[model samples]
Target: MHLPIELDRDRAEPLQNQLYEQLRGLIIARRLKSNSRLVATRFLAEKLGISRTTVLLAYERLISEGYLETRPAVGTFVCAVLPDLVPAPQINDNRVDDLPQTELRPPLFQSRMPVGEPVEPALIDFWGGPDFRIFPLKIWQRITQHVLECYGKGISRPPPSAGIDPLRGAIADWLAAQRGIIVDRDQIIIVAGAQQAYNIAARLFLQRGDRVVIETPGHAGASFLFESLGATQHPVPVDEHGLLVDALPDGSTSLAYVTPSHQNPIGGTLPLERREALIEWARGAGAYLIEDDCDGDFRYRGMGPPSLKSLDPYGLVLYTGTFSKTLGAGLRLGYMVVPQELVASTVAVKTLLDNGSPWLEQMVLAEFIASGEYDRHLRRVRKTYLERRDCLIAALRLHFGDVQLAGVDTGTHLTWLLPASLPSAPAVQEAARQRGIGVYTVSESEIGGRPATLYTENALLLGYSSLEERQIRDGIAGLAAALRDHRRAATG
Candidate 1:
């Protein structure tokens, strides 16, 4: 009789091993009764379309393992009893209620970010990601080739948990010149991305029942991270000028995460006056601040205010930024400039978290920054993004009468408030999506619980960094048509 066995040629596992495991599992499950006669090797091989020798090897392993016995004159047969080491599997009735009732503890919170299969991209996706066309691939390729030649052995070895010297130094120098922040190279720790940096910071600073102040309608990623750590989150509202410093509650808070340079979703930059006030608040409360300058590298307007970290005097701000926005997110490269006091703990935590970021990426990025190629590239990309931004603004005006936009002066994304004539932001997003255009509602982007205010209700976010001028215009036109169709359908 042909055994109920299946084999795959494409899997990395050897065919003989797969066959052996299946046969052993079947025998242990008692699917093949004790002392059942087995098929001839030649017949089994012909039926399975594998070599006769492959079947023989599987049979030999089974026999050696006490799952099978071979009669000298006859074909192989199942053993009457399994070895002491290979106990027979206890067969169950396949009834759900009969299964043991064990304690099933679910996670405290569900992740807001999308998981599993990635959401399908729109025909003209406005989701914020780097424009691959503008990426300096040739320069990177040359640097990568050079690194491979020079540091072939380095690839085999693990890098320091804190990071390599060259990359840390390069980042320190760049921050000094660009953001006006003076930090030591030793204080910088390379991390997988901004998310990982946030994780490291949370681990270092937060504990159960600790209080965290998060910007409402802010970054979902940060909100989720803080909450997952069992920290009690106190959400502060944001306005046209970013987080409301005057509205900050008077109390003790362990940590606060802010995107000051270009406030996410709403697109407001924290002004210098408020920045000073925020620093003072942190000092009074003795809370640490995490500055996530995720897209600070690309600024259209000339020189926004100095970073919150640059203005910080108490060394309470842990400044974090990522090359994902400028380079590519797939690289998963980011850095955190730690304070003098926290450097040791940061390094320890980083070492505990997967040893360290990869070596080759850090090396290539160091070369790119030190060689001044990174600066040159940013200048070119900034100019291109400005043109795209302008193109999107014009298209919006042309399609819909003069629209109100925010956070347009900086960052890759901008926010739009739906007009009185148009449907709600979520409705608009759905209409645009149906027409193969991607747009996001503000609530969709924010994490911590929504406050009573309707800041997120009528607002939509549009990311134009990845789209070209033509695509932006086309996308807006399509969006307009979709909205019109939605209105028509509602009226009918």
Candidate 2:
């Protein structure tokens, strides 16, 4: 009997494993009838152009699972009685499932962030990704080789609870040089990324029902993290000047998280005066200020403001920085500059959460920074992104006559406020998505519920870091056409 078996050699799954799964599937689906004789292992192997041993292994798995029975002399046959298979319990539209749910001490709220995936065939993905083609791969390979050669056994050495020393020093020096912030190496703790750093901060500071402040129309994932910790949100609205320091409540908060340098969702840079005000608020309230400087590196127009930590005198600021925007998200490396007072406690918490980030990346990054390749790479990418940003602006102008753009002078993306002529942000987003382009509204980026005001109702965030100039122009043009169609349909 010729079994309809198709194997993909290109796939990562082992050939034997694939064969076993396929045979089991066929039996479970009842395509392979009960008591039906299966082809001999040798014959099947010859027919499938695979080793006889591969076929034997597959057959053995099937027999062990009771999907097939091998007779002493008569040949292998499908089992007369198939083993019971139960469909897996599924989470329905409501989060609750048929399976028994576990009760926890404090009521928990599970949340997820909407991540953008860029498929190979995607039309025009504005999903925030680094152009790996521009990454310093040649230089990286050399540095990696040097690190490996210099420290053979050191690679396997258990990393410090804080981080590898050289990396911490490099990070400190880079912060001083680039971001105008100087700190001891002991204060910098390496994390998986900004998210992990946030997790550590949440654990260290927040208690049940504690109030933590976040910006209005801010990143949902950030706010949701605190929310899940049983903290009540004290949402302060964000304007062109970043987080409103005046709106912050007096003396009753644990932490206040802000993305001051190129604020997430809505790009706003807090001025020096406002930065000072925020510091004072934290100082007075006895609250820790969490400054997530994820996109601080990319500034187009002029020298951006000094980092919040740079302005810190009282040591209330916990400054966070990530390699995601600089190197790439795949690096999964970020660091937090904790207050000297909180250093020991935070590092102890980090040890419990995760021993340390991977050693190879730490070693390689240390070398990269020491060799000044990281700075060089940053300089190169900054120029490319500036050109791309300009192209996007020009394209939007060409398609829709001089549209209003915000956060243009800095960061990988700028917010475009839709004119009254165009449709709402969601309508435009959906229409553009159908055209194989992604134009995200602030609503799409929110992890928590939407804030009170609708500052970004008609605003769309366009990330230009990963896209080439041509791609940016084409994507804008497509979005323009999509918006026009939407407008016409609505009018009719």
Candidate 3:
């Protein structure tokens, strides 16, 4: 069979290395199917004008790595049992009946606020969190490989319901030194991510028909999870400081979800006074506060704000954090620092949820943090993200002229309050999409509660961390042109 293979003989790298890299890329990207047959070495070499020996060597390396295999007489084929090439699981129709009858009934679809529209491929994605380019890939790769080698034996065994002990220990030490919260490792429950952590928290805390206080225009994931679990959501307004403690509904609020370090969507950091007041209110109301510190690692300007858990003398807070934002979302490693009284119930719920997170990732992350690589990595990315944030602010000001911005003091992204004369946030977002630039509105996120005019009309959320400086400038330029064209058409 003819193969789409190209070789650069003039390049400094060996032809074999190039062949291996290309093949690896195809396999990783899932372009090459499992058990697919390959062209003979002779035919491949002839096609690429390379020596047959080079092609043979590349095939041999791939075979050794379990990415390819050869049958003595059947010829060469991609490995059907490649570690990373598992077939997609077929959905079982019978599983639908396994859920309870009440849950089987379709939920009443109560429409809530709109979320940020997804960025199209043709558009620059500046709406997601974190700068992927600045993630410590090299360091993380080393740690991952090292952990696999050193902890392979342990990881191969079934992980405990509580999670990897060393990882929980590492997290405990991290919290003590970084956030000033002292707790036993047993109190920590490792989960897939913050959303899963919220699920567990809701399961443990919320009863049906219970009232839950959520930050207005907060992280959509938490709000949705609470509602899914049958908690009647009470929207608490957030101003320049943070969630309005006075705005919380009177009576028993089972759970209060907040992003106190850097409020999601708006990026307002709750001050110490407000933090104290909120905690006091929680104590009086007998409520549980779920503090999501998803982007707390990238505080750009001030001294680190104290986490809500740090100030909780009565054990009213459940702290949720994830490496997805700091490292990458692919890691799927996060933990919930539960109150001592609730730890047992939380762990039980975690066990029933998914057993526990993958053992290797937790071990590697533990070593990464304990060896101080994690802190160093955070420092590097924090500086890079801060610079990118500044560049985005500069670009917006240069193009749009005197834009009002918020949430830039901390977190990976900030909100730009669009001038009334230009266009609405959603309209500008749609216009930007036509010009291949991604922008967002609060309604596009995991927001609950009734639609307020302020959320839909004024604010455009721009995540600057993910894009390169030139990409940021170019994207904004594209958006400016789109807006101009829009205005021209409107006037005409």
Candidate 4:
């Protein structure tokens, strides 16, 4: 049988490591059947187009892991005495000493955040655009006022570490009803937003030098958070379909942070097959998967993919979400749901982070969501954003004449892949700035990522959720004119 092995030279993972990973995954997934003879290194390497030395190194490690064995004068075969493969027992206490398992190891500013009250910016900004127009301010105001009215000044006492009771309950219910993630309220920890959640997960699971994989051209805020904790960075490149799961290295890592729902700046969703493969990869490597669904709520594509948490059966996915995108960033409120295994450590570390998020906002949001006003609000915003997304597409097409755009299927921004006929992304961005229109390139839009010459150098990220149809049209028009002027100057 031809053993299934493939490698991508462009991947951030080393050739040997990628080879080691796929073989191990095949065994763990039971795709490479037990006692099956593997192909010889010389022949297999030639078949896969890799150096024979690379295959030998990968095989050596798998032998050490008991995934494969070589019988004298026979051939390499799956190990008869396979290591135990079962979910690790959950730790009942909050100690960092939990048994090894898929351990619960475990930033878009600029779409309209509030300043006391939200205001429209003077420049026609395309990034960080939040719909402040129909924010249901009256309901939010009433709920905030009611929380103070009922609780009096005594609401200042330290709230539960897990979160305010009603808020946690509301979030739990909302996840089940909308996202198909069912969990108890206690499993949720109210976070300041997604940023603090990343910090908390790092504190709980990441030891120094623990490898953390992040999507290339991913949210820089996430990469910075893990790096701050002294975790090593391993960046996996993303494509139009989403995170490339086959690139995950076969080694111990504390966590892998991915924006599967609408991959940060690129806006691609991982299909179910890749999601399942990723979960299996994590299971084999004994790492946790932090699934950040920052914009999963507003998917333009047909019936978006399910949350990784929803598909996780081995207790390997740490799901992080925020209201900053759906409601408003001013709320500064988000929540994370831990598998029952990691709840104790997660809450303990979260308490150390902030002692808990602000009490009043929790109470007010709890009331808003439970009373069903939050659902109504989402319905209003989703329709508006869908319309806004369509308008942006129409405007770009009209002005640029067959421009390439991405992330349109979800999230607030769409990446405009600059045509070869035009100048580079940075030049267009500068020209647009001169016209008082805000457009961001990969460097500004995504978290700290190594330059992907093809995507980052020639792409401009545009956010349209906060702009009106008229503004979207004018902004594209302004960019078109700026590009024309830039071309004229270059020629002269």
User: Which candidate gets the maximum lDDT versus the true structure?
Assistant: 1
The regions of model 4 sitting more than 4 angstroms off are 1-122, 445-449
- Candidate 4 all-Cα RMSD: 25.7
Judge candidate 3 against the unseen true structure and give its global Cα lDDT, from 0 to 1: 0.83
TM-score of each: 0.82, 0.80, 0.76, 0.74
lDDT of 1: 0.87
Q: Which ten contiguous residues of candidate 2 have the minimum total lDDT?
A: 98-107
- Each prediction's RMSD over C-alphas, in Å, is 8.6, 9.1, 12.9, 25.7
| Model 1: CA > 4 A from native | 1-90, 94-118
Task: Give the alpha carbon lDDT tens digit for every residue of 307-415 in model 4.
Answer: 8999999998999989998888888999999999888999899878778888888888899999999889888887888898889888888887787877788888788
lDDT of 2 by residue, 249-339 (tens): 9867898899999887678888888998889889888898889995788888788778889999998899999998888889999999998
Candidate achieving the largest TM-score: 1
Between prediction 2 and prediction 4, the one with superior lDDT is: 2
lDDT, candidates in the order shown: 0.87, 0.84, 0.83, 0.83
Better-scoring candidate (lDDT), 2 or 3: 2
Q: lDDT, candidate 1, residue 19?
A: 94
The predicted structure with the larger lDDT, 1 or 4, is: 1
